[model samples]
Target chain A: MTVDHEPVSTADGGEPRFSTWTGKARGWALRRLPPDKLLPEGQPSYVSSWIYVFGMGAVAALVYIIGSGIVLALNGPTWFHVSSLGRFINSTHLWSVELFFMFMVIHLWGKFWMAAWRGGRVLTWITGMLAFVVSIVTAFTGYLLQTNFDSQWIAFQAKDALNAVGIGAWFNVADLGQILMWHITLLPLAVAVVVALHVVLVRMHGVVPPLEAAASDAQLSSATPNPATESEHRK
Target chain B: MLGIQQTDAGMPDPGIYFQWGDFLIQFGNLVVIATMVVLFILALVIPFPGRRSRK
Candidate 1:
């Protein structure tokens, strides 16, 4: 019943614990993302613009969607199909998804107009797009799991198209077990991973500056071209 | 029975108090399709009337 109070020492005058992958990860993270840069209290002044806020809104909506989804999942599938309370929770999840999609589309369009890939933000941009694609796939599988007339019609009508393309063999929406696993587990997990990476990249590289600000700043910097300033703002 | 069973969803419900309450819900499919079509067209031709949008 006694717990050991002493730390384990390595045999060869060095600790294996400090020299492991965990230590390397800690060092790498600290070097790449210090706490102040990772989670800043004050953003750059240019982020004050209205267009920059939609990304935050999308993240917020995603949080709500996940929270509601967990609640609904805990209640099981039949409750949401039949009970009033479950129906309300289901509706909340649905509306949250609608908001998530709306925010994502607006954010994507705004970033596109901003030419947000300027400098080294290409991976940030791509991950966001990939998250959207994953979310759409998740949503489609969700529709298949609806257990309603809508789901029925979608499977009935779309099965031919899918089979013709050979996708139906692998991703059979008509198969409840397959689609449900995808809806509840695989797709959502993929989306979460991609979204996490997207946010980390955003935090790693600070929010992109406005075109005018970047242009003026570029002009002020030394004549040597900074990769960040290589953008030609469409005038 | 397993392949194409129909559910009671989308069937008309008795709405003595709210006759037209389901109108929007009933027609939402068409609205969604139309909206997608419109949005796609807009995306293709948007930032329009110039070489590139100044914004």
Candidate 2:
């Protein structure tokens, strides 16, 4: 048998080799960093503002809610009703949820008025808004799972409203077992999937540049035109 | 089966009567809804700073 020892080279005379696991892992880590950290594409000097903090605050609230919720789930619903630790976990989850919604809504609205959807970022904004709506419904289902007298009344009332809106047939609010399953399983899964998609979209498009800075610079300008100027022109 | 047994447990069962759980659920729901509405209104009311013209 003849032993062939030929070096692999590309048409351009460069060495031809597949990326190793280390190379791929390094690329992944680099891609995961925030825009300010990873890339040389510097943020505009005008990017500093209190308005920028709400999005991060919303993310923090989401972290708290998910962590507390997991603890509550591990203890089980019945334990939440009986055990002190479980009750505290449940309450923490509840408060975290409240905070999450508060911050999320503020972030969403701020982004809207700031025209943060410019620069081909509409899809990200839309996905995030859908996630917000889904989260609200999930929270509603969670309340019903408490299996308290409050849950019973809210179930009846909410069922009536849902029936009036023509969706009650699909989701029986009165069934504690059903509500619990949806809360701990279906709804959270949906939220997680939507959130993943939202984050991926955000990463792909990158954060929307501050309106003033982007309109002035117009460097890596996207298809979506400056919203402020367009609105002004309309006026 | 559970539902059938629960139904057989009677209308005036102590669990169903004077149920604090039901009251709490109602209260919680009301408070959450009210808070969401108030926040939404506040969001609409708050005027965001105008973007400076890019000269």
Candidate 3:
């Protein structure tokens, strides 16, 4: 396998890694959100707001959820559903999801209360919300994969709801194998992708400034930064 | 009765509401879960249209 690391130029036809669509995307990301901007030594003083902890908490809980989920997945349903150690790991996975959802809800509420879309951070807010919605779907599919009476009941109930919206035909919540695949593979992959995009946008946009700080910055701008009226914005 | 009402067949019917007075004997996970879900959708849709920020 030959490794071509050089930038692709259409003129040279070498499939440049830095000039193609993938290259352009990487370059755009690096230019728009440098590493220093993605992670900083210190946050804005206004970021000391306690509500911000919810976002970190959500991320931390997801780490635990994914780790425990991996353990359970490796053990397989036969073990996790029946064996003592497997059950323990299963419980841990369940609680991690609960924790994740709790933290995410608090984070959402906090962002909403803060009007986190301020300061031209609309895409950041949108990405965050999309991640949340995807996470919820992931969590739901996990519940259906539980292999228990509760899962059975939930599957029956959820299938009707999905059917009502024309989503059931595509997803078929009552199908055991389908839900297992979704819970273990498809949904998680979707969640991870959405979450990554959300994080990228968060890094690119910078965290939403507190209302007071945002208002002051608007007033301080020499270019008359009326975010309320401006169709475009500057960094 | 609320929560899981038993059918003659041994399956449970998740109730939406309950009736109780002296102490409180019933709760419905389905209704609560469904309501919270609907609430999430409403919460998402209510504010700005997700296109742009506004004061």
Candidate 4:
């Protein structure tokens, strides 16, 4: 296959001749995450601890969950009860979701202790926290969409709780269409977007150094206005 | 059976529960929480392959 080898002509100011949207987007992306850092060949030695793996583990489990979910969606919700293959995929999806939550919670705990938000990474921490909240809502909707006795009972109980809080008036747990759409579409999309942002921020900032390192640095540079002590200095 | 149907659905198994005043949690959930705590500790202590721990 032949591909265009010619580059876009440049203006006198060195901008692309046409200033196409793709060119601008590419420039913006490169500015945000340069090639070397975005796909680094190595990380800081402190990142060798096993705790660092949980974030990637959560992401891997999410991949399996989405893959199995696609299969279940294609076969329709009830097909799992009737067919062996569908049942297998359903089981895969359920187990993957369980792993996803387990890994994500572990990751959250690791980050909390490490204060992973250090060094201008507060947005990373916020995005991760948002992903966890969105994921909980997604999982709740999934439970409601199970189409079983448990789901029916859960919906009724949840309805009472939501009504007590006055949320049931606007968000009906008993409404299958609403819950199904939330489970299959809206909540998942929200989770995906939040998780993507979290990963991008992590990549952009690089993994945070261990707490001891940061503490020693703060002590060494007590007079300096580094991120670790900037807030303390503020007060 | 259209979807995942419980074998006996009178009331789903309310697994073992523990309560301390107002704080209550199911046994299974407690186990999950405990396991995560243990895993976090282990992850902190466990060394990654081919890497020496920084002094």
Candidate 5:
């Protein structure tokens, strides 16, 4: 395989930096969200709450889930059934997924209480919810890939549900090949993209302050330099 | 009713189910849910350590 490491353009012409597509895209991204805000060194003091940890915990669990899942995918379903090492990895993948959901659910609960969608953060909330929905589907497809009696039973039950909802036309839960592809590829990719977007939105908007801190920030917007609003206004 | 059934193979028998009226859930799922609830409560109640400021 040939490696193309050199820059596409070598000539130091007098063209404007933003003339190229990459330059223009960079300019747009930087203008929308500066580097400092995208990766802040410190958050507001109001973020000193244990509830904030669950979001990161969920992300960590997702990392483990994906890593273990990659191993399982490499080994295939039969390896997991026959090999002890494969079985261990499969169990690791399963437990990681369970932990991921647990942590994500707690994060959701915390965000719900914090009114994390406040201050034009509707997209962030929507993306998070979308990730949750997609993760559920991903996990369901994973169950169907287990290739056991439980999987068979779940597939039959889910087929009827999908049929009732008219999704059976395009999506067949009984089809192992189709479900395996969904479990291992499509749904996971969707989850990753949506979760990444959610995180980017959170960083773009900054973490939502506590309700009382937000209310006070509004009341003292004129008198004091509200760091939260200051960042918003700067943006 | 919540105990795991152990078979002669020494493996914990799977498919332990708990039901209340028409509602049904695996005991393991119930444990997960309960643990999540507890963790959520503790997270809300517990104080998070603040970052140390540079002197």
Candidate 6:
């Protein structure tokens, strides 16, 4: 018996098919470049407050940390142990991380207190918080990758505690090489993915208003009675 | 997290290993841990009146 087979089209075919990165898609990506900067033209009128600075400040610190980290990586971990320039860069990177965590913690608190998660924004808040938690783990691993005396001591200490807690098999903090790869690759990628999702959610939901106004509006509408008032009351 | 053994083999002697760096590291660690504790307490204790209003 003879079997018939369908022919597959190739480049030689008369008509050309465009790739996913075609003009329209490329334009869409470009228009959405720097996801966090989507509101460059204007933020919502309700986005006023010094509290908002913490989020931007955290991003700035992350930028500095990544840039300085790249320089340190180029120098190699051992360079910081022997070279003055490398040491300075390492110190700067360390301070940048400290500031990054500090700002992120404050930003998280501010968001929580403001109840910024309201109005269909819970996902953004949760994603950003998860990103923060992942960044902390990444930082911890990076510290282990330093391969200095401090790194060695911290690794042994942390390994002991983690082993006691029964998670030692999954994460070997003493594996400097593996930890370095995770710090430079996996962690950063995870952080980037979560941050992208966070920005998308924020844009879709828009910035939440201050609690006072939102509450007053809720009370005012709730005090009145009607289907429209009920909807407004539910706000 | 890694291998766990009760033996103290390869562990540096705490008595002979004291240094300014170790002191600084310990002090810094304590400070960070303390700050986090305080912040966590404040987060829970402080009345989030604003959030109630917003809702």
- Each model's DockQ score: 0.05, 0.08, 0.07, 0.41, 0.37, 0.06
lDDT of 4 at A23: 66
**Cα deviation of A184, candidate 6, in Å:** 1.3
Identify the runs in model 4 with alpha carbons over 4 angstroms from their true place.
A1-24, A164-166, A214-235, B1-10, B53-55
lDDT of 1 by residue, A1-235 (tens): 9743343467865433345566667757875676876777765444545566668887898888888888888989789878999999898888878768866876787788778887678999999999999999888888778887678778777789899998888988889898888888888889899999999988777777656665556422322234344443211
Question: Model 1, which residues run further than 4 Å from truth?
Answer: A1-20, A215-235, B1-55
Local error of candidate 4 at residue A30 (angstroms):
1.4
For model 3 chain A, where is the 10-residue window of minimal lDDT? A219-228
Docking class of 4: acceptable
Candidate no. 4 TM-score: 0.79
**What are the per-residue Cα lDDT tens digits for candidate 4 across A1-96?**
874434466654443433566766787787577787577777766777899999999999988887887778788966986788888888888888
How would the candidate models be sorted by lDDT, starting from the highest?
5, 4, 1, 3, 6, 2
Q: Give the higher-DockQ candidate: 2 or 3.
A: 2
Better of 3 and 4 by DockQ: 4
**Which model is ahead, 2 or 3, in terms of lDDT?**
3
What 10-residue stretch in candidate 5 chain A is worst by lDDT?
A: A218-227
User: Which 10-residue span in candidate 6 chain A carries the lowest summed lDDT?
Assistant: A218-227
Q: Per-residue CA lDDT of candidate 2, range A22-112, in tens?
A: 6555556544543543333543334344455566677787778878888877877688778888888888888888888877876787788
Model 1 chain A: ten consecutive residues of lowest lDDT? A218-227
Error of 6 at A168 (Å): 2.5
What local lDDT does model 1 show for residue A173? Answer: 80
Model 5 achieves a DockQ score of 0.37
Where does candidate 4 clash, by residue pair? none
| Candidate 5 wrongly placed segments (more than 4 Å) | A1-23, A214-235, B1-14, B50-55
True contacts kept of each: 0.00, 0.06, 0.00, 0.73, 0.67, 0.00
iRMS of candidate 5, Å: 4.7
Ranking by DockQ: 4, 5, 2, 3, 6, 1
Candidate 3 residues lying further than 4 Å off, grouped into runs, are A1-26, A217-235, B1-55
lDDT by residue (A109-214, candidate 5, tens digit) is: 9899879898778999999999999999999999898888778878888899999999996999999999988888999899999999999888877788777775
